[model samples]
Target: MELSHEYLTENREYKDYKDFVANCKLTKPENFNFAYDIVDRYAELAPEKRALVWIDDFDDEKIFTFTDISRESKRAAAWLKSKGIKKGDTVMLVLRRRYEWWILMPALHRIGAIVIPATDQLLQSDFEYRTNAADVKMIISYDNPHVQTEIEKAKVNSPSVQYLVTVGPDREGWVSFHGEYEKCEADFPRPEGEEKTYNDDPMLLYFTSGTSGYPKMVLQDFTYPIGHIMTAKYWHGVVDDGLHLTIAETGWAKSTWGKLYGQWICGTALFVYDMNMLKPDKMLQMIAKYGLTTFCAPPTVYRFLVRQDLSKYDLSLCQRFSTAGEALNGEVFNKWFEKTGKKIYEGYGQTESTIICGNFKDYSEIRPGSMGLPNPLYDVEVLDPDGKPVPRGEIGELCIHVEKERPIGLLMGYHKNKELTDAAFEGGVYHTGDNVTQDEDGYVWFVGRKDDIIKSSGYRISPFEVESVLQKHPAVMECAVTGVEDPKRGMAVKASIVLSQDYVDRDPKEMEVEISTFARENTAMYKVPRIYEFLKELPKTISGKIRRIAIREKDNKKEDK
Candidate 1:
């Protein structure tokens, strides 16, 4: 089927991208399952089409056809059912980029269970919270002793967890997932009347990064996969039957953004790189080795990639580049563009929704730092404090208009927290809690989080602007900007910085002086950080977002002491 531009606007209230976004028509179906509608449908039509291309750090490689994935996932579904997993049961998957994540996810969908993709980097406390909050029934994890040890400790506090299934080598007291699958029939029958699942049935639950407090569960229904059609096909420009690589562990929401749902729905081969550690040079080498066609990663990864010389490897095969998770600075964006002649198309979305704003393929005009236009499918708008629409070019809260009803891509509300959900939609619009400004031409530029915006001496400042300036400095490697409590100014701009390794041996006071001087010259004097803390590393959430709240809290505690 040839996808038309109308597919992006099908059943939507808005005529085109120009209408002041309001009352979007959300698409719903009687029985909607991505595995059936997208994946399995493609499998039936093109059984031998390449579905996934996987490679590990050790250079091991494998390619799975749609038929292979369909068959293996059926066996996995049977195996999971035998282990007592059922509909609505939550299963935590801690496989980092393993091909098994692909098999197991579809398997969970086939069995009508909820899959919670989690990172193996979780500490015991993190594990405890997620397990308790979600009432996780089983944990399917890698056999790494370090992660296994944390799971063992978390089990003591999580009584609802009934099984530990290991993906790799056998671990004591843990069931071998591979071994169990080997015994199961490859052609297992689907559950009785399984085809009757509605579009609203919960298929996945993602725990927010918890930068503020304990993570909130974000539940997405079966139709969530349909929403990502714009994500991979339009925004990422994924090519059919070509490999697309998104640098994310299987745990994070970015995996869904790039790996399984959208890419498979587009008939593109998903690339999985199971690496033990992130080495920018090694990753580039792998891209060359595997002939990666399209790539997406966070700004953090791009920061590291730009530092390495580009002439050392062949990136000619890569056709499209995209970024999300956090704001991308103009410096890194320009550098990558200079090297590869490929502009990194910035996209904006949250754990709560699919790609809401992005630089689409048809939009040839690339703004260096803009987050592009609001996605055609979503009724997005910039609103002021009173929930009124703000004038164009004015900064305001980013909100999704859900007057017709929440879209399929949007979360079903904070799981079990109606109060929070109501608060989020109190103004009749789904407030994203992010502050941004729309240009006269309609491109949305990220300012900062509403809470992260610094109010100093009656002036509002975006931390991202300061961080963007700081990133241009040669001595700086990474930085997080936050507001520190100030009696005179209400709040003072503070920068917690990590210097490059070459500058580590330099005197701390001297390094601070250099950074402050660079900031003063590069940006407005009032925007420059008044207080600076040189650190070995900035605190980050599991998904790699710098936790400015943690830094603010630590600063506050020190003052109290």
Candidate 2:
């Protein structure tokens, strides 16, 4: 029996959520390693099974098999071992969607060495902070002029690094990874004695692409991927042999959410669009070309898709679509639905845990703008600051209560910051810094980032709620709502918008008044923006979340608003 079956005790096709969550139980085996038990197991059972279908920016295509990955990872593990990356040693791979990421990451896991998957887009300062923060001993990266220059610059300040490796080209002072793997033996034995790993051993660390403050290092145990079964099967609706695509860079936790872990475990062939930048036309072409059965991306991608001539694309084969990273706009949801007749499902979680809530099939009805139900594996609630459960109509912080049962995918801790970790896990509850309201039907509506809430004349406002209304206007493409410094209300509702291309030439004052009027008509009076700023683009984190703090800072320094 497979690991999924071993862990997922009964009811694979569960429909009623209350009954499904009530019976959901994972059987934890004593010493389970994903690379060996899952990856190699598939290689043994079905060696020729397709693992990855990759396309590059140049329109080049390549395919890989489970056998190829298993062999490559073993060889890579041996080569990494030869380079002195042993158990518990930290190795950061800056290989963005390059197929090498698939091989090297699992290879790191097989040897029990800690893996930190960073993006190739890191600057020198970013690299220095990550390397020193994680005590990374080795760095494997995609070789490019900028990336190469930054790594060399960071290495001067990053003294923990003992070896430098590159994947593509032969460079001086760097081990050519592909060249070394070819020469190394295809079999690597697991380290003996102290090298053995428990299911709870730290296997992965992700630096949260945060909006405010320094990035927090999120640590997840070896069993982390098991939790994403909820992500792939239930939320993404992935099927074996079908192609599934989730847009994410290797550095982010979303890659493991889509590309690796659950998709592979569920036997889905992952579609990787390894490109320098995202293009709406390119993604649509890939969908039609690959016959992608299931797909997930951030709402911004959907916003761009809705901008294109969507009617020209043939995407009938795609069974389900999902979005995360930020709240899905109601207008984007409605437009895509009108074009494709498919409602974009929403999921919510963070680097610290797997899918906490989602619009899973049959388990929850399609509530166009809702984040669906909490995953059956975890106990989710909206709690007040005092830790008491908030009423259905009220807004509160979203939290996962682990007192009764600590689910399989919860983060181990903040790697080295016990203070932040303890504060997050206070009262046996992990408080997600998201504000939300629960409806009578238990569907959760995202309000806004916890810190981005606006208090206007004693009326608390949700920026997300206001933006959802703004998105309904034809002129609005993407928008961010943040509180501006107000002398009377303490904070005033301000809208920073990126207008749709068609509306660009329109007069700014007219467009603003129209959008402002639209919001006033649709939402509560206090939620309407008192000030509107038109922009070419909104400032966003690498993960695609709007940098509201940046918007707020710019709003603060203004004298006569």
Q: Which candidate's TM-score is highest?
A: 2
lDDT of 1 by residue, 397-425 (tens): 99999989887688888887899889888
Query: What clash count goes with each model?
Result: 0, 0
Q: Among these predicted structures, which one has the highest lDDT?
A: 2
Q: Candidate 1: where are CA atoms >4 Å away? A: 1-28, 190-195
Cand. 2 TM to true fold: 0.97
Model 2: how far residue 514 lies from native, Å: 2.4
TM-scores for candidates 1 onward, in order: 0.95, 0.97
Error of 1 at 377 (Å): 1.0
**Steric clash count of candidate 2:** 0
User: Compared with the true structure, what per-residue lDDT tens digits does model 2 show for residues 243-285?
Assistant: 8999999988899998889888788888999988888998998
